[model samples]
Target chain A: MIFGLVFWLLVIYFVARGFSSRRRRGYRWLQRELPSWEQKNIINAEQGDAILSLYKLKRIEPRRKMDMVKVLTLIGAIFVGVGVIFFVASNWQRIPAPIKTILIMSVTIFTLYMGYLFSYQKEGFVYLGKSLLLLASLFWGGTIALIGQIYNIPTSQNWFIMLLWAFPIVPIAIFFDNAYVHILASALFLIWNFLYTVNNSVANYYYPIIIFLFMLPTARKLLISRRINIIGLLVASLYCCFYKYEWLSLLVSVGLLIYYLIQREEFVYLYASSLSFIFWTITFFTVRKIHPNFYFFIPIEIILYLTYKDKIRENLIMCLVGLLVWLNLSIYSFCLAFGYKFNVINFIVMQSLAGMVIYIIGIISKNREYVFSEIYKVFGYLVTFVCTYLLSFQAMIELRAQVGLNNVYLAVCSFLIGIMALLVTNEARKGYFENKAVRLELFALASALLVNLILLASPSVLTCTLAANAVLVIFAIINIFLGVELKMSSIFTAGTVIFALFIITRYIDVGWKLKEKSLFFIVGGLIISSLGIFLEKQRRKVIERMKQNE
Target chain B: MNKKIIFFFIAVLWVIVVAAMIISKQSILRKGKAVLLETLPVDPRDLLRGDYVILRYKISTLDLDQVKSEKPYYKTGEVIYVRLEPRDKFWEATAVEVKRSADSGIYIRGKVGYCYRKELGVIYGIESYFVPEGEGREIERNIRREKSSVNVEAVVDSKGNALIKKVYIDKNS
Candidate 1:
């Protein structure tokens, strides 16, 4: 109860803070910049007057007032729906089976009717009606569960109940053109499919195909949201994963890719296609083990690049990353197929060389219109840093074994890679990369290389591993601090994940002891909380400084 | 509007589907022959389905010695029919058939679970009997204390599909 209270309080606080911050920021921008914009001739006097009038008009818009009302209604509807569910569940045993079923069915049908009436008849209450419709769908599911309980049906019949609930909602969603209902129906359908597969212990190869066909008519009629398509693709992908059917993966990938190609304007299609392609490739490599077909991906990549060259400016970097992964896998397979022994150092060297070649090509081409070249350049620098780190470890291992030519060769390669990385960092700092964040990352890489070199010279493997772990922990802390200063959510998330990894690894290594583990957890929690407080303070200062600069 | 018509049609169809399911099950209960199978009490509670007992019957695991089939090998997941004959107070499997026979007798259909050495595991569908919430625990305690037996009264159709009618504890209704 206390946890729930605290959670709600935190949610309320954050929501209030968000609204206040947005209002303050808007007010500040207007106060600080409106007169300047007028003076600078960005806006004529008449345009400025129009803008101010429009802004005022927006504040009292009836549509906005209606939106607030709709939100409140939706919340109230959800609460009432939940209350109904609980009421039914609690009084289930006391109520006769026939009356219970009738009550639930009547309630569901009534909600649906009311929703339809409001949506069709009442203006400015469309959202409220839609929310009611969604509630009706939810209640339909509740009705199914209640019936199941009343009839004493086995849990295995859950799939059938879900199917019955989902089929009706699909038509409702399509007719209403409600995205929420579409999403809910899609989710229920997927769950039904999953439950059916589990209970039957059968692959159900035609399940995805049937679902896709069922959705097509509705999707065409409603112009269904991209979310539904993505969900469908996810369901298909999940089925492929469970069934380990290469043909299904191929079918899904090819189907999505064709659909995306046809609907080239929609980024969601592209996203789904790219995800399915990756999954298909992974499945091909691991499940099928058909290494000879790896070469086929080269022509496919070339075809994709050439066909989409005009639009490459938008998604080239992502496509190139996919290609790079495919190429690396192909290379690995080729080496294995031959009599060559698998060597991590050799693979890294080859991959880094490929990265450099791509980078050099990008530079020589001077494709200023596209940012693809710039991405290639950054990829080159990243690959060089990673390869150098690996080389340093290899050189250290070789040196420890004996003072040999291989050790000297590895050390020389590491030094060259490090020099190349530094030069790339310099080039990036010279404004070749556009993003200022790359400079910080490049400097970190340089320092990491130096630290790696020093740590490699240590005598024992344990010492090397420990030093690496400590460096990782320190880097994670630095990332968190930098994220706070820069206001980069991705960097902050990475730092949090790395810190979690460190804790997990330490726990695994130490195993479990009651008192000791508890103490460890307490100390860790305190450290993290303190760090968060410090970061929060720093964030405020940074934001203030940024505002002042602006 | 066309959409409303379609929506109403779908709603009616959905109701028909659900109604058909209940009616079909009810018909099976009303028309099918009833038989009692002795049950061995196992787990007393299901996490999601409230109070239930995992009941094992004598026919759940069959011995190869009782095999009346000409085929030497039976694959898993293949449907097999077991002809039941009254043995003492409860029915026991007398013969196994890979295909349904013209001779109408008490039979139960099950899927082959596994064939190992001399024992074949079968899954009959009527494996669980759910009681009211908290009643399962009391039934389990009584069975353990008095060394009592539980029998499931199931109605089996001509197609060998069986549904649990009721459960009798210590020969009580």
Candidate 2:
């Protein structure tokens, strides 16, 4: 029964992959290139024919780049897996118990086969394959569940069951040499730790050490990037915070950053310690809202010293962004839990300053041509636009009565952001930046500094709202002009979409009653869709213009 | 060749695991003593493993006075044994203790859930019973109508481990 189940599952999986995507990749590559090569006399017609024959006879092709087929396959896998899980969960009486168990086993085998095919198959989609392996891990858990269902074994939310699911995949991740699979294994192991501890404090500091051992092998393998390894270290450091050793989690986080600054590639020192911190913080948040210990800033100070000494700009910037996100959530949760007043206006002001900090960092990263330069710049623009748009609401009159920024969290956040601006200025003085970008960076810094004062003074909601709407219009216009200058239509379209959303949001706010807001959303979605069409046309125009110039 | 060997090994390993799981569960059911427990069931649909009734037994919560523990409060996940005495066709908790009595004939083991000052909640492995989809709501409705109607027959091994064998709802309730 098990063998048959496994066989049918494999057949179903391959059939799904085969039917959805045509394996005409090589043919397409040949078609695109062969004619051009022939016209250029790069290859004779006879040679071309020979290559075509080779492709046809061997059923082999050049590897594909990113395409719709892989995406479709990924999406299809998710849908099918979820559908099967839901079906299994239903415990349908129509399907006999044995059949239900068999079906689950089949899916488990099928997903694992797909994962292996993707990750380890000769000429496999390694990136997609690792993701598939993670999905397979999930299916394996489902397989356990179905078995539990079949035999009336109690398995729901059993922490031991999660450990069972996690352990088997750890070897797979290491053997397959896939970072994403390692991440999945790490996350699952961490989740198990949380779930188990919630059951009882049976696990000790050794829990994090176990987690570090998982990473130790991956780090030694040296297949993944140094940056990912660093991130992994940071993630592992999450453990200490989880077990109420908040100071330890924070120290480990800084310690990892410092360790990476000093350590050589693929060599690790604090393997046991890294595991302790990440598991604690992530697991802590999973079980209960964690208060950021006062020790948070101590790490920032250490990071500043390291930044000054090492010029670790890329990791530092990414680390700052990660900390910003983590700290933002933790502080908000702290405020809510402690009954501190949460003012939306203050939040908006804080976000804008945060945006300025991100934008300035983006500018600096772009000047240096860092690996994730575009991403930082894009995120910077996104956060700035989102905050600005939020602030543009005309209904600020109702929000005028508010707690004046008594938020120590906001102050601490600003201080962290101010450090970023200072770093940018220090770099600019060293002549490490271009004039245009530096100017923009300085403007963002000044704006951020000016707002901190306004935020501190508790400006009236009406004045802030008017200023925000004007700034929004100005920023949108600037984005459109920048797009034209840079010959990038995505930004131009974004500018158009933002301006439209600004108008539409206010109309939605005033004209639409609470009941009719869904209509507003529908219309807003259509507008964005139309703007996308506009973007495609404008993008083509720019391309054509560049081609003509060439 | 190495990859092929690993694949075959993993495949065989899973088969063994599934087969082993079945054999172990079957062994417990075949050799264990069957005891009936009066219970109530609540329903929740598991995303991956269909709709099921969560059985909260009358014995799930024990008063501090009833249990003979060294301390007043028991920590979560601490193991405890409940000695059962058959009362009116269903076994009821007669005594609770931290140490299992080797001399006892009928008892069940459970882990301590978040124990409050006045009450200690325990979780036996046999808490959830998977029911057919769309049938769980009806079962829940029946349970609501007759609170004392639900009774489950469970199999207990020599080691004090228990598995829920069957659930019975009183027809005249």
Candidate 3:
């Protein structure tokens, strides 16, 4: 009931907000622009006058009024449909089987008839008709359930029945051009497919084949949105993952990538496809234990770079990052596959070598305007930071015993990397590099190195962990102060998130002694509250200073 | 006008399909022979089907000796016909066959749930008996307290498919 109330409230709020905002904006635009258009001779004086008079004559346009009516009718239809379902469920056993069947059939026919009648009679009632049709579809599903119960059909048969019911909706959705119906049909088919696969305990190789043969054609004919297609494909991919169908998942991911690449203008699809492709590739590797090959990504990156040559700078940076990740993974895979005794020292050395090479390339690329060198520079800095962290971690682990030559070597390498990063930042500030992001990257790298040094100096694991966390907390505080000084909201938000992470780690690390836990929480709460107040005050001061300067 | 007529025809067809499903089931129940099987109770709730107890019977698990099938092996999900004979208070499996026998006395169709060595687990479609909301727990409690078993009155058609008629919970308790 609470959930229903909340859902209805949200619906009402959004509808009211949408209509009011649209109307207000429409009127405001006409008022502000009509006179200017007339003066600019974009519109004639007569046309302008006619437009203004037409706007004033109608309080709301006939079309908009009809939209309002349709919205209300749709809402009413949904409520009635739900009421009918509840009425049937509550009084199900009381009714005779024949009577129950007849009643459900009657209701289904009545709603479907009314839906058609409303749709045929007037354009304004189309939404009302669509709502009724949706309800009718739901009633059809309910009828299947009713029959299943009446016949005491096996639970496994339910999916097949649903599949049959959903089959008709595809035609309905396409013929009517109703997105809601399309969504409903897609969801039903996916659900039936999922249940059918699970209940039968069968491998779902047929799912993709069915989708490609039937669903894809229907989706194309219906002109269903990419969102629905993406969802269906993702669900299919999930099933493939469950069955360990690596090739199928790879195909789906590659298909999605190609689909998005063809429409590379839409960033949403690009990002979504990238994420899904990465996820599928990682999962496929983990499941199949395939030897990682950087060569596979090279052709794809080259294709992307060539295809998106107009946006060379951004695409090049993306390709570079992809290549770097590929290189790292390939190295790891090679070490594993060759059965090399891969120690931390070797890992750090490889990473540092790659980082330095990339940093040099970035420094050279900085002179060119073909791409943003900041991406490569930041990537290099990140690689160095990771290598330093690993070395320091290993050194800390070995600190309990006598420090070996390997540990000493790791520490020296980390210190030298940190110095290199600092020198690079100094060079960047001297106008050799124009990217401010590179400076920020170096600052972060310097902080990481400082923390790593602290960890290396600590004797015990507990002390090292605690000291590292404390340094992070201190870094967050420094970041917060710096953000306030510069009045940068992103920096402030980052600091706040890092501070929260520190608190969470502390909570997890500390033992669950009641007194200690309580004290810790209480102290933490007080400190956070105090810091919040102080930040708010600083924010106000910063705003005042900006206002004065303006 | 043409669209409305088509929609009306489709709607009528849908109604007929639904009606036919129920009518066919009801016809079988009316024409089939009735038998009572003692039920072993287990409570479960379905979201759409309301509260219910999963009913298990003595015939659910068939011993290799009781099964009179010519087939050497039975895999899961394969349907087998079990011929029941009235014994004591309820019917027990007299014979099991892969196909329906022509001289059927009282047969119940079941799917092979799993096979473990010599024992084969069978599941009848009429395993769940739905009750009103909040009544499943009460029925479970009643069955537990009475120490008397619930007997399900079922009707089996010529096809060996059984439909549950009613559940009598401890009439003598």
Most TM-score-accurate candidate: 3
Give TM per candidate. Answer: 0.65, 0.58, 0.66
Task: List clash counts for every candidate, in order.
Answer: 0, 19, 0
Off by over 4 Å in 1: A1-68, A79-99, A121-128, A150-152, A205-207, A214-225, A290-370, A377-550, B40-58, B63-78, B94-97, B112-119, B136-149, B171-173
**Whole-model lDDT values for every prediction:** 0.62, 0.62, 0.61
Pairs in clash, predicted candidate 1? none
After superposition, which runs of candidate 3 have C-alpha atoms over 4 Å from their true positions?
A1-66, A91-94, A121-124, A155-157, A203-229, A247-272, A282-440, A446-489, A492-518, A533-550, B1-5, B12-37, B59-124, B132-137, B153-170
Q: Rank the candidates by lDDT, best first.
A: 2, 1, 3
User: What is the fnat value (0 to 1) for candidate 1?
Assistant: 0.09
What does DockQ give for each predicted structure?
0.30, 0.49, 0.31
lDDT over C-alpha atoms for residue A49 of model 1 = 65
Fnat of each candidate:
0.09, 0.58, 0.31
The DockQ score of candidate 1 comes to 0.30
Winner on TM-score between 2 and 3 is: 3
Cα error of candidate 1 at position A254, Å: 2.8
